[model samples]
Target chain A: MENREELKQLIARIKGGNTDQFGVIIERYQKLVAHVVFKMVTTEADREDVCQEVFVKVYQKLDSFRFQSKLSTWIATIAYNTSLNYLEKKRVPLLDDVAPQESPLERIAAEDNTPDETAEYKDLSALLIEEIDRLPVQYGTILALYHLEDMSYKEISQITRIPDGTVKSHIFRARKLLKDRLLAKYKQEDLCR
Target chain B: MSIKHLSDKRIQEYLDNKLRPESLSPDERKHLDSCQLCQGTMADYSHLYSGLAQEERQLLSPHFTARTMAIIRALEKPATAISRSSLFIAFVAVVTICGVVNYFINIKDILYAVEAFSLERLLSGSAFVSTMEQWSSRLGGNLNILVFAGLLLILVGLIDKLLVRQKANRAYFMSV
Candidate 1:
C-alpha cells in the first residue's frame, strides 16, 4: 500500500482527460482481476470476456472509486461481481444446495486411487491445486484471494462484499472440507506426521 | 476448566495465527501441547495452509492487458448519451402533461357531464379527443394548434417507446 499515493496520482491523471493512461491501471491489476475472475467464470472464452469487461467497468466507473480502499481491492470488487453476474447469466452452479455437493475427497474416495491421477503430482501443492479447481466458485475464489493473493479477511471483505466473519468462515470451511477430503484419501497418521 | 477440548473454530484461529498469545489461556495452551488430537489436526491444517499459500498461480494470457486496453478503446465514447431510464421517464412525463393540458381545457365539460349524470361526455371530453370534431370542441374552435401538438407528441412518444424497446431487445439478444 506504499504505492497508494502513486496509484492515486495515476488515477487522477486518467480522470483529468489523459484517458490513455488507463492502460497502466490495467497492467498493474489484471493479475488480481484474473485471480477473482477465473474462479467464478469456468469457461475459458467467457472468462476472457469477463476479465475484459471488469476492466472496462473499472475504466468507466473509475471516477466514482473514492480512495476508500486500495485500488486493487476496488478493481477486485468489480472483478468479483462481474464474474458472479456472468455465472448467474450462464447458469453455472455456485454456492448452490441442490444436494450435499461432492467435495474433492468424496470423488477421490469413489475412485480406485491405486492408479491415482495425483500420482503424477510430486507434492501436496500440485494435488491441492487440482482439488481447489473442483471447489465451488466462492470457495475457490475466497481461498485464492486469501492465500495466493495474501489478502486479509478485511481486504477480501471489501472486495467480495462478504462480511469479514463470513470471509473467514468460508476460508475455514473450505480448508476444513479440503482437509477432511485429504484425510480421507491420505489418512492423517500416514501424512500428518 | 469445564471444557477439556478446543473446538475446531479455536483450532483454526490458532492455525491462522490470529489468536493472540495472551488470549490463549495457560490451560488451553497446555491442553493444546499435551493433546495429541489437537496437535495432529493442527499439523494437517498447517500442511494445507502452506500448500494454499504456495499453490502455483494461474497466469493471465500474456496479452491480457493489451486485450483489456482494446476493450477499453472499443467502449470509450463521449458521456453525452442519455440513459434509457431517463428516456422512459421523459416519455411518461410527456404523456402526463399532454393529458393534463388537454384536461385543463375541459374542466367545465367534466363538471357539467358529472352534474348531468352521464360519464360518456367526460370520457369523450379529453382523453378520446383525437378526431377533428373532438379537437374543435376541445380547443375552443379557434387554435387547433394545441390539440394537434398534443396529438403529435402522443404519436412521437408511442413510436419512441416501440423503437427503444426494439433496440433494447436487439441489444439483449446480441449480448446473449
Candidate 2:
C-alpha cells in the first residue's frame, strides 16, 4: 500500500515525462492487476493481453487521475473494467449467479475421472482453487480480491462498482458457497485434517 | 439454558476473528469450546482462510515490464513528434488562409450573382447570363493559384498519413 505522498511523487515524476518511473508502478501493482484479470479471464494468451492493456491504459490515462482513491484501488478498478470489456467483446457471460444445472461441488465431482480421485489427491487447497474457478465470474473475482489481494469490502466495492453492503454479502455468500462445496465433497474429518 | 450448535455464519465470523471474544455469549463460547462438530467446522474455515492467503499468484512473463515499456516508449515518440500545439498551429493557419480568401472573393456575392439570372429567362433562352459570365471570367485568373494550394494541402495530408502509419507500425512491432 503506497501512501499519498509517495504515490504523488511517483505519479508526478511519470507525468513529468519520466515514463520509466511508470514501470516501477507497474511492477508494484502487476500482482494486484493479475489477481483481477486471472479470475475474470480463463485463457493465458488473453489474460496476458488484458494485463498489458490495463497498464497501457493506466499510463495513457494517468494524467486524469485525481487521487480520490488509493492508486492500487484505481488500478484495480481499471483492471476490473478492462477485463469486463474483454469478456463483453468475447461474448462471455458475466452472470452473477452460479448456473442452476448443478451444484458447484457436484459439477467438480462429475468432471473427475474417478469419484475418489479428489480424496486421493489430498490437496484441499488445489481442490478449493478448482471449486472457485467453477463459480460465477463475479464470485471468483470477489473471492480473489477479498482473500488473495487482502482487499476490504469497501475497496472491492469501489473497484467493482458494487454497493458496500452488497460487497460484504457477496463475500459472505462466496465463502459459504466454497465451504459448502468442500464439505459436501469430503467428510468433515478429511477436510479438518 | 440449552445452547444449540454454532451456526455456519458464527463459525465463519469466529474464524475471521470478526467476533471478538467479548462479543461471544457465555453459552456460545462454552459450546464452541466443547463441541466437536463446531470445532471441526472452525478448522475447515481456518484452513480455507489460510489457503486463500497462501494461494500462488499467476505471474506475467518475466519480460512483461520490458515489453510494456517498449510499447510506451514507441507511443511516446510519435506523440512527441506531433504535438497538440503544432496541430493547433496548423489548424489556425488553415483557418486564417480561408478567412483571407473569403474576404477577397465573397461566396455570398457569387451566389447573388448566380441568382440574378432568373430561371424564367434562362428556360426561355432569352437571358444572356451576364452575372455568371462575369464571375467565371474573374475566377479563371485565380484558378492556377487555387489548384496549386489545393495540391499542396493534399500533399501535406498524405505526408501526415504516412507518418501516422509508420508510427503505428513501429509501435505494433515493438508490442510484438
Candidate 3:
C-alpha cells in the first residue's frame, strides 16, 4: 500500500516524462495484476500477453487516472477487463454454463487417471485449486481478489463491477463449494494435514 | 428440548470473523461450544481459508519488467513525438492568429506607407502626410471589426487544435 503522497510524487514523475519511473509502478503492482489475469485467463501464453497488454493500457491511460480508487484496484480492474476482452475475442465462455452432471468430487474422482497417478498429486491444496478453477469465472476472480490479493469486497466490486452484495454472495458460495467438494473427497484428517 | 443447528451464514460469519465466538449470542455460543457438527464445519472452513491464503502465485518471467519497459519505451517515442507535433500545431495556431491580426491591422497601411516613401512620393511631403492621416483614421473606425475578426479567427484556430489533439489521442489509444 503506497501512501498518498508517495503515489502522487511517483505519478508526477511519470507524468513529468520520466519513463523509467513507470517500471517501478509495474513492479509494485504486477503481482496484483497477475492474480487477476491468472484467474481470468487460463492459457499461460495468453495470460502473459494479456498481463503485458494491461500494463500497456495502464501506461497510456495513467494521465487520466485521478486517484478516485487505489492504484492497485485500478490496475486490477484493467487486468480483469482486458482478460474479458481476450476471452470475448477467443469466443471462450466467460461463465461456466454447463450444469454439473455429478458432484465435483465425483467428477474429479472419475477422471481417467490411474490410482497411482491420482495418489501422486492428491495434495489437498492442489485439489482445492482445481475445484476453484472449475468455478464460474466471476466466482473464481472474486475469490482470487478477495482471498489471494486480500482485497475488500468494495474493491472487488470495483474490479468486477458487481454489487458488493453479489461479491459477498459469490465469495461465500465459492468457498462453500470448495469446502464441500474437498470434504467429500478427503477425510478430515487429510485436509487438516 | 429441540436443538437448532447453526445456519450456514452464522458459521461463515464466524469463519470470516464477522462474528467471533466471543461475540456470538449466548445460545449460539453454547451450541458452538457443545455441538460437534458446528465445530467440524468451522474446522473445515478454517482449513479452506488457510489453503486459500497460502495458495502459490504464478511467477511471471524474470524479464517481464524489462520486456514491458522496452515495449513502453518503443510506444512512448511516437506518443512523445505526437505531443511535440501538437505543441507545434498550437504554436502555429498562435502565430497564424497574430499574423491575421497584424495583416488586418497594418498590412495595407504598411504597404501604402512603403509606397509613400518611394522617391516619387518622398519628393511630395504633403501627399505622404495626407496618406498617413488617412491610414490612422481608417484604423480607428474599424477597431471593433478588427477585434471581432481577430477573436473569431482565434476561436476557430483553438477549435481546430483541440480537434486535432483529440484525434491524436484517439489514435494513440487505438495503437495501444
Candidate 4:
C-alpha cells in the first residue's frame, strides 16, 4: 500500500515533466519489463533493446495512464507489446498459434526405443528448459511469468491481456504439459522406485 | 476389487496441494496409499515441481535502468523538435487559413468577374479576346487569377505534406 503510494507519487512527478524522475520509475519496473521482454522476444540481441524500448514507450505514454491496474502490470503490458512488435517487424510470426516443431510428444513419438528402456540421462534442469522452450509460446510465457517471475495469475492475466480464468488454465496446462513430457521420457515405475 | 485411477487433472490438483488428506474420501485415500501408478505419477509431478522450483530468475544487466534513461533522454530530444516543427506547421496553417479568408473576402470581386462573362460574350471571339486582355492587364501577366489558384493549391499541398510529416513524427515518438 505504502509502496504503491510512493510509486504513484513518483509517476505523478515524472508525468508532470520532471523527466529526471523517470530513472527511478525505470529502476523500479526494469525487472518486470525484462521478464516480459525476455519471454516474448526470442532474438537475444533484440531483448535488451526491446526492454529499453518499452520504457521509452512508458515515458511517452505516462500521462495517458488511467491507474486501472498496478504500475508494474502497466509496464508489463508495454513490454509485452513492444517485444511482440519487435518480433513482428523481424517478420517472426507469433509463436502462440503454432505447435513448436519439436514438442515432447513429437520427440517421444520419433524415438525408436521405448520410453523406459533407453534413458540417456541428461541434467533434469536442462531437459526441463529444453522442453519448456518447446511448448507453445503462450504456455511458455505464462509458465515463465508464473514460476520463474513469481507473478500471480491475476498479474499474469493483466500483463498478457488474457482473462483470469485463462491465466489459471494456462498455468495448469503448462505444468501438466511439462509433467506429461517428463512422463513420456521416463517410466512411472522408474520414477516411483 | 478393480480400482479406478484418479484423472490426471485430479492427481495434479492433489500434488498442487489444492487437495488435502482431510478433503479426500476414505476410499480415495486408501486407494492412493496402495496405488503404485498414482504414487508414481505423484513422484513424477514431485520431480517436475522440484525442477520448476529451481527455475532461475533472469536478471537484467546492472546498467539496464541507466540504458533506459539514456534512451528516454534521446526520445525527449525528438519530442521537443516535434513541438518546434508543430509550431512551424501551425504558422503555415495560419498563413494558409489567412489565404482562404482573404480569398473569401474578395468573393464580391470574383462574382463580378463571373457575372461579366456572359454566354454571348464567351461565344464572341472578339469579346472573349478583349475580356481576356482586360483581365490579364488588370491582374497583370505576372499573376493571373489562374496563377493565384495554382499558388493556393501549392500552399495547401505544402500544408498537407507538413501535416503528414507531423503525423509520422508523432507516430515514431509514440512507438519509441
Compare candidates 2 and 3 on TM-score and give the better one. Answer: 2
Give the per-residue lDDT of model 2 (tens digit) for B1-176: 24599887777667666567865678889998888888888888888888777778447888888888888788776665567435854895588558655855678755755565768657776534676666656675664665576677666766775777687667845475
CA deviation > 4 Å runs, candidate 3: A97-99, A187-193, B79-176
Residue B54 of model 1: what lDDT?
Answer: 78
The window of 10 residues in a row where model 3 chain A has the poorest summed lDDT is A184-193
lDDT of each: 0.73, 0.78, 0.78, 0.70
Q: Per-residue lDDT for B82-173 in model 1, tens only?
A: 25544765777677665765665667654543444446655657544344355456557544555576686678767766666665544322
**Better lDDT candidate (1, 2):** 2
Report the Cα lDDT for residue B168, model 3: 57
Better of 3 and 4 by lDDT: 3
Per-residue C-alpha lDDT of model 2 across residues A82-185, encoded as one tens digit per residue = 99999999887866565348774556556654535555546777777777886778888888898888888889999999999888777777787888787776
What candidate 1 gets wrong by more than 4 Å, as runs, is A97-106, A113-118, A188-193, B1-3, B18-20, B77-176
True contacts kept of each: 0.84, 0.61, 0.68, 0.64
How many steric clashes does model 3 contain?
Answer: 0
- Each candidate: how many clashes? 0, 0, 0, 0
- Overall local distance difference test of candidate 4: 0.70
Q: Could you say which candidate leads in TM-score?
A: 2
